[model samples]
Target: MAYSIINCLQAAQDGVDIICLSITPNRRPSGIATFFNPIDMALLSAVKAGIFVVQAAGNTGPSPMSMSSFSPWIFTVGATSHDRVYSNSLCLGNNVTIPGVGLAPGTYENTMFKLIHARHALNKNTTVTDDMYIGECQDASKFSQDLVQGNLLICSYSVRFVLGLSTIQQALETAMNLSAVGVVFSMDLFVTAFQLNPVPMKMPGIIIPSANDSKILLQYYNSSLQIDGDSNKIVKFGAVASIGGGLEANYNNEAPKVVYYSARGPDPEDSLPHEADIMKPNLVAPGNFIWAAWSSVATDSVEFLGENFAMMSGTSMAAPHVAGLAALIKQQFPNFSPAAIGSALSTTASLYDNNGRPIMAQRSYPSIDQNLSPATPFDMGSGFVNATAALNPGLLFDSSYDDYMSFLCGINGSTPTVLNYTGQNCWTYNSTLYGPDLNLPSITIARLNQSRVVQRIIQNIAGNETYNVGWSAPYGTSMKVSPNYFSLASGERLVLSVIFNVTNNSSAASYGRIGLYGNQGHVVNIPVAVIFKIL
Candidate 1:
């Protein structure tokens, strides 16, 4: 991972316009560095050297505190879906259809196969846990070859302490080992409520939720029932499923709707004093059902992709869209700093969808039921990216180099000389900084006391624009903007303070936005993220 990061940094140093990272660590990594090493510093240098870095907010999400790429310099992108839904026929004998996502490009002869349950076959004598049954599937040797062979095995897979991908792999591998036609996976509850990663499998398979299809399996399967009469009776537990057709290449695949798997934030990489919690997943993009060009030489194509184009999904797909936009923005403004381009994207993005509603996000986990709530900055930073609006953003919360330095001071809360980096002398210059007060497009307050006030400066980039302040108040909080109405001529800047005071309330996270709308059709939206508690 260090070597790869270094290689990318070197490419940026060699003048690469945009850098995109679709890959993530094999394991969940903690800390912002792999040893506070110089390679990590290289990432900082690359972004500081005017290269726009776009990173994937790893697919392990809908879980708070699971977000990656916390660097403010890097544009962290999340996965979202457009409404052009894909349909694959996967119906049970009882005529119940379960939702699944796949595109095989050719129709298969739908056939009924005997359904074998791994748990029933492996542990008939002794009662075992779900993990033990999962182990039987994960370790193919644990299951009886006579029982599993030539049948469609039903396996229970759960996310214990890691991403669900591993469990999916285990279930599929078990079927492959036994010469089984296919495997039906019952996904255990995860933070992501409803997720469908359209990967090509060896034979063919579908992941059904334990809460849904698994119940259907138990209800219809005669093998799961006991003998009530002289003869044991069995109900039909067969399925007819056909996997074909990838998401078509079209521009109308609607998006900006959060995927259950897209990483949400209150970033967990708290390496400095005040850096414990910052807004992330800076923007969402069309990640699911993405029909992207594929390489014929790719090895995973046979198992997880298509021949010409593939329907790949993840933050991996989302980051590239933002990176491509950054490349265009760089071409439009040759001298624009990376930070400036980031501000443009954030300030110009729309927080609302075409339905005139706040963007919908599913953020739930464990015993919590999935709830589609209006997304806030924490769910989707500044909202979805708008390349057209970003190109000529009328106003920008342009963060200068010093502004970032102040941000570091805010994070470290230590004397600048303590770290001993060049031009970072907090002791010798203006040092005190607030995390949210750093002139960035969005805001995040890790710990909002009884009342907290932060200042923001918006620079007018468009000619002679007057603006009005419009905002959403956080739950249990009253918001006040001093001098809400204002005007800014070209090349002018204005400072405004947003005050968030705790009203009669309990304790939790609060999310809202402060919008600056101009008369000349210019709009700047800044998200406000706060974790308010009694002081």
Candidate 2:
């Protein structure tokens, strides 16, 4: 039956162009080889037909021997974060009150000092004092008195025991008992740490840098040593310096290493032990922190709180991007087969990282052999997919549907019989009777392997003088024309078809549209709904 179908398709391949496939895996019982699934059979068939297939690497990582999107006949992609740097310090102003510690209205020398506010210590009504040492005060009565009356408390790290006793409940109790407004505790010199009230506090508290703490302490000490009248004076010191964004934005050009979270690989060695035998992850695409069109409903929903848009990190996001580019490639070279297109995309892709060096080791370090590196065949295949390169004439490979079926039958040791040719609804196709008359014109889209192929027929009721035919496919699906301009003799019928291979199975569930174009801008369209189901 497969042989008959192949013969029919070959006979009808007059004006056919390209074929593409999207590959995926099927579920199987444990301890069994998983290579004979339907999807795998379809992919092998598409490759034999010489079509292109694009695929996505699975999002399983942060460990050794992970199974990524692995398929020898398709292109795969990885993800990355945007090259943006975050600020380490938050800005503060003079109006921000530091009640426990006195700021003698003067700027002072910078020194490292830890910051501890009453809020962090779980105390509410504590005050600060220069003479009050940390970890030394034993009596709650004396400590409570010092905490309430003192403007600021200065103590050695040893007194932390007294402060540590101030639990949330105790702090609340102390707040009521002392009627103090605020507190400030100095952090240990070796380690800097602070915490805010788990619950809201009536008074505000902040964590300042050690340098700020030292400056405030020095100014307080200087003021206390001065005469009474000196308190009114405002001392000026050098301005505080900070790193700005404008200067740091150039960091990408300086250091373009892969982020810490991206997956790394060397085929067979890094891939799941079972996946070592397959041609894993045919290629790689930009999956890192990529920005794309998001659903308005999902973005605008209140569940996100105030954020309307969000950035996600995963291979899932990267899969659709490659799908969209496949559509573009299809549009440019309609005659290329899906396997050819896949090969073009992989072989023509750029193997170099942002640093202009071959991507060898996983993550972003350089290596000696481009192919032998752990990340070579697994983490990334042929580097990142280049849309423009795949569209170029030099990168095209053309194949037919018969070629694909032959490949599928070869892999599974199954011969295609009339019973094996499933119809649109998975019913058997009747070869005896011609199919129902398709309204206007219709195309049957099918996937034998990981590639999508269309079976289109043109009836010439009007004496065919080369009538124009045109259509369009969705964003991720591309189309190509074989024999772009064909001369159909009068009263003659022509059967034309093209196949689109799925490159990345990760995005197979996405909806795509196809557009057909012909002489004088004539156009027609067919919607392609790609589905990914786990068998």
Candidate 3:
């Protein structure tokens, strides 16, 4: 499937300035046994053909080496949270408030409505069983209008809702038909854990996602109930509640954090347990709960079934953000190469968010508490992208088609291997280059021996200016850059030799960055990560 798409892209490469491949196949093996993926090689072909490629780092994340976009030539993107989020609350008649998620307007702050559970409002002759959708409010005909009218209807979050057999949209329709003022979804006690993203609601609503919280709501409802003492357990409902406005977005101070599901980096390499020098996710972009256009006929989001737009999340969405930014950069610099554009984005990215705090990443999966740690180069590449900064990146780390070919050759990719994917013979170019010599904006040394020398050549695309180099050395490692300060004119390039020396042996990886502070208010940042082994 990917091969076919690549073929089509190759055919249309001339007209295409940027290609955002937002899909990923099942992960391939990582080691010397496999030289290159056919899809990756095809993407390289597109890059060499002057088409910039942006890829989504796969969604299977919060784990190490789980990235599916590992190629150095492709500008891979990961997901991060933006600064805005809709937060709603459920205020009970007893003055107890529970936090929840719902994207809908709220009733007046003091306007409390009579509340009734769905089961308590069932039709006298309804044939639906409790095991079905009776309490889910999927069928208005099965509910009594007199019992639900002018009331906030409480519905059950059952297995049917989990399996996609029942949806909040259906419940909403039933609520509207029954003349209910609002709706509340009580979490099922049987389902131990469930994560609910915000759902779009036309009317006021609140979804209690925690089982314990649902139990408290149910207990409150039972307390206000007038039971008939019959075997059927009939009830005259009397609970009251109000819905808080959720449509108003709250500003998240700690935003641009690498989401829990966003794929991490340290690209896999030719040797088992050893990663590549390239970063997997080249940068991070807003991907969580992004409101985007949706096809009304699409069934991907039940909440937006008939709506023209929906809130979506994933690396696929994140990749398009980068693709759009790349388009902007390409428009400003029509002559910019694919490598130059990517370099501009990475070098100008923000390691800190708008709040002036270091960007963080979710370190654990299913994090109810949302445990986070400072994000590393592996977590968010350079960082969340800064659109304004990217357009005027003072310098760019540029590479050519031949440079990529040499990288392929460095992996000992044979002529037949190169020919199979790129249709280029390995003998046509210099094949002795090392993987670490790819001149990328970011540096990663998967296996750092005691001492190593790496070099970078950056071109000044802006006015003539003097740049003073500053660096933070990785833990247990010392770094020295020759000619700490230099001046360059527009369109001129300078070579920098960086020497790395190990001060102590450590088993884990460490990270740092090299910053070039220009006199003209231009800053270029290069992220560096080094992995250490016992000496």
Residue 527 in candidate 2 has what lDDT?
A: 32
lDDT of 2: 0.37
For residues 300-347, write the lDDT of model 1, one tens digit per residue.
Answer: 634342366667778898888998998898898887787888888888
Please list the Cα RMSD from the true structure of every candidate, rounded to 1 decimal place.
6.1, 17.8, 3.0
Model 2: ten consecutive residues of lowest lDDT: 433-442
Q: Cα lDDT for residue 220, model 3?
A: 94
Candidate 3's C-alpha runs over 4 A off are 2-14, 29-35, 126-130, 158-163, 189-197, 210-216, 219-238, 267-275, 364-370, 412-415
- Error at 55, model 2, angstroms: 3.5
Residue 422's lDDT within candidate 3 is 76
TM-score winner: 3
- Please report, in order, the local distance difference test score of every candidate based on alpha carbons: 0.66, 0.37, 0.83
lDDT for each residue of candidate 2 in 339-387, tens digit (9 for 90 to 100):
4455446545555566766544433211212223324333453446566
In the range 271-320, model 3's lDDT, one tens digit per residue, is: 53324577768899998888888898888767678888777778888999
Model 1, position 300: C-alpha lDDT score: 63
Candidate 1 RMSD computed on C-alpha atoms after optimal superposition onto the true structure: 6.1
